[model samples]
Target: MAVIAPAGDRITDVAGITVGHHHRIDATARVADPESPGAGWATGTTVIRIDAPSAVCAVDVRGGGPGTRETDLLDPSNTVQTAHALVLTGGSAYGLAAADGVMAGLEALGVGLPMDDQGHVVPIVPAAVIFDLPVGSWDRRPDAGFGRRALAAATVDVAVGSVGAGAGARAGALKGGIGTAGTRIADGPAAGVQVGAVMVANPVGSVIDPATGLPWAATALDLDTYGLTPPDAGDVARLGDLVAKQTVLNTTIGVVATDAALDPSSTRRVAMAGHDGLARAIVPAHSPLDGDTIFAVATGTVHPPQPDTVPPGMNRDVGLLAEVCRVAANVVQRAIVGAVLAAEPVAGIPTYGDVLASAIR
Candidate 1:
């Protein structure tokens, strides 16, 4: 007797959850809406926080050489446990500066790690990013100051599309690049719960259909509607040759937050489940060169208990934790897909529609 929400069921509000974000547009990238002027991130950071402990749990990368930090600590053995606070920024690995701002912000609000008798905070921040300055300039890298600014501007009603780490972002062939959405699961059946997501567009692949699991950008399009071009197909071996000539480092990362009461073990479960959501959106996901990561936090307000919360052989109930994590994983993946679809054409960058057009033609 298991009940799981099907895909595309806008469940932005599951528990008393909310979001806030800030985006900066780069003056460098070619924007489709030349007339559309927005804050340029050339360097900026995004901070997502839940009022209560956004529960804690997560899964690691599916690829080698994936860029990430504090992921290995999810094992429960590490001394690096954390409350709810995830920082997703713009500068590949270098953007880690954003976390400092987030930590400082959280510390100011007294929202993270138990304080020592001395009043010191053990901040555990997990971060991710994408390579933006591929056009020959570090003009799009996020900055630490931006992370601090994002925290100062954090809220429950979070925004999406060109906000946060997504400001200077782009996805597929569409002008699309940053997107955000939320759904409420609190009411008659699932009362007192909420699930929400904030995603950045910097994937090394495409987001597509749920049934076929194929990316729309990778398929043919019927342009009569918009004539979108599919994302440029990279040459396999021939592509490798070209890549060797031109090294392009890319990644897409974000955080998944929930109000479900999850322990360290359960947190890990939620983290794993969130990945399902990622796979649902991106084709050939978790590939090498992709620094995909997820952070699951529990506010401990709601108790969605797991009989065996700890993982086998471990000093925790990882089993039950993993189950809910799986559900969360599904939600996170959907969020990513939503971000891509929601992404609009920007600075001359074709929208997902444009990519579809090229493929169809």
Candidate 2:
């Protein structure tokens, strides 16, 4: 059996990839106070920048209400085969403006496709937004400046929890936030390949199973490493109360990246497989009210495995691409759970950590 192990516990573990985040949190005193300045400022922006000039990219939008920009250009048949950056943001449609700032930033850095010899380069930045207006004042969502700051702050050390697009996010009845995880292929045909996922888990459906007050995928995935156990009746009751009040529509957005060399078409397959992880972690995923989107990028730093046997149909290693997809799905699932565990409460909503801790009477 090929061995795969967690690496760096962040999306940045995928070489040539860096992440940045900028957000505003609503004040306790001014919670939902529309009259206050920046009172409803619990939204933010997250940027996933490709550090190697450009990289093959693709997207999978499973939710019914996605707010996106430049996604069509990423199609395998499109003229643009690579992307400079990807934006996962709050602010719904309005937040799409953030990508503009990223484009300008990349332009300043001389990163993008060369359009003319006169130093004119057009950066291909694709973006998606999660509806987080209800978290704060509707008008206080992310803007171009948010994107700019996040891009400027890009680094390999990713910070999970209540930051970036997940600052005001929710998972079912619990608070939601950012999370990341990485995997390294070892002792396999694709040895040294790196796969990682970073997700903002703000879903309309529950991340936890109501019956157990624990994530639905935890048992099957052996997520005891997160220190989560079946909750007592008190914990279940508390979760029930929160679910009743969590009526705001929201979505989950993320980026899954790999170091393997893959074409746009293969990258798209990776993106599609990532959603399986989302479905595993969040109950009733891809709901009509949710705008779940996952962007997949291939840095192409490592060559994908080639069939070692002649007459390729007989080789077991022919399933190398399938292995990558499976790893992508696994990392995504772990990232969602990481988000749930790392989250902090917003506006009076309690985090899963809080509920679990309070139950320990």
Candidate 3:
């Protein structure tokens, strides 16, 4: 079969996947008083749903400080290798409550494993959170309601930037937000495999190149997803000044999905490779203060190549798996860039566009 890219370049491009967001942006809080802290509410929750209730899943966590739930169950040796849903949110550890809401929502929809002779089912949902309390009102963090809302709103047309889990996110000195990207394997043994990524970018490192005012992943930009422009010398100089103000508390969390068939071990490898994409896009990434985590899911839509049928050098199954990993990393890098570019300024945090406008002026 020939590889055909999806019309939507976002993570929803992957078949059997849907994304949703629920956030609160307080008007008064938007206008923060430098003298007074925690004035606004700019945090929210994002949920990624797989059509298959038991899709194969794995997680890779590389940050020094990670706030996650049910990650241990994802281990290959664990009893449950499948996941029903995944949650990403802002609010530090407090945001974890949102997962409870997701569980309830899924339960209501009759999704999850059968508990016993009774009709009770338990949904396996893993969750992760980024520290956005510094930018938004700590009092108004994500809760069960936020998770339910996000799940209820799940759709193929995902909204990116300054929303969902990325609402209170900041990338170094610039605003951070939600972003997604996807691609189809055009050729080779992995032809027709569809891979995509959704990221809530709130990193402690820089996503832009100080020397060019462009995303470090500029080479991977597709269709000018962020409306990028070449930076002038002045813009470059300004970026240098901004990097000097790095902070120590932040995280970049996300999920990657593929239509290709993969077991739990393969999914774990893909998740690890996804971090490579993060490193490529963000300078000084996976820092002690950043809880950078990536989750991988395979819907098993397309079967891997048979080892016995393919050429020896090809190692078809292994080669295709590697290709999926490569695409997963690139998509992640692009997603991070998309988050920064599409973000709207909030809570006095400047966006990439705001910085661009200032530098050009």
TM-scores for candidates 1 onward, in order: 0.71, 0.91, 0.91
Model 3, which residues run further than 4 Å from truth? 1-6, 30-35, 220-226, 307-316, 358-361
Error of 2 at 131 (Å): 0.6
Assess each prediction's global lDDT (C-alpha) against the native: 0.54, 0.82, 0.85
Q: Give me the candidate number with maximum lDDT.
A: 3
Query: What global local distance difference test value does model 3 have?
Result: 0.85
Error of 1 at 22 (Å): 3.1
Candidate 2 residue runs with Cα over 4 Å from true position: 1-7, 29-39, 310-318, 358-361
Which run of 10 residues does model 1 get worst, by summed lDDT?
Answer: 1-10
**Candidate 2, 53-148: lDDT as tens digits:** 447899999999899998898899988888888999988899999988899888999888998889889988999988877777778878888998
lDDT of 3 by residue, 129-152 (tens): 999887766688999999999999
lDDT tens readout by residue for model 1, 1-361? 1112233342335453334455555555553233443333343467765455445546455544455666776676666555455677776677777787777777776666766776666666677766655422355565666777887776544455555676556543333244444444434322445555566756665565322223433334322322334334431233224223332335667666666665666566566666677776675577786776766666666554335544567734344344445556555665665565555544444444343333333
Better of 2 and 3 by lDDT: 3
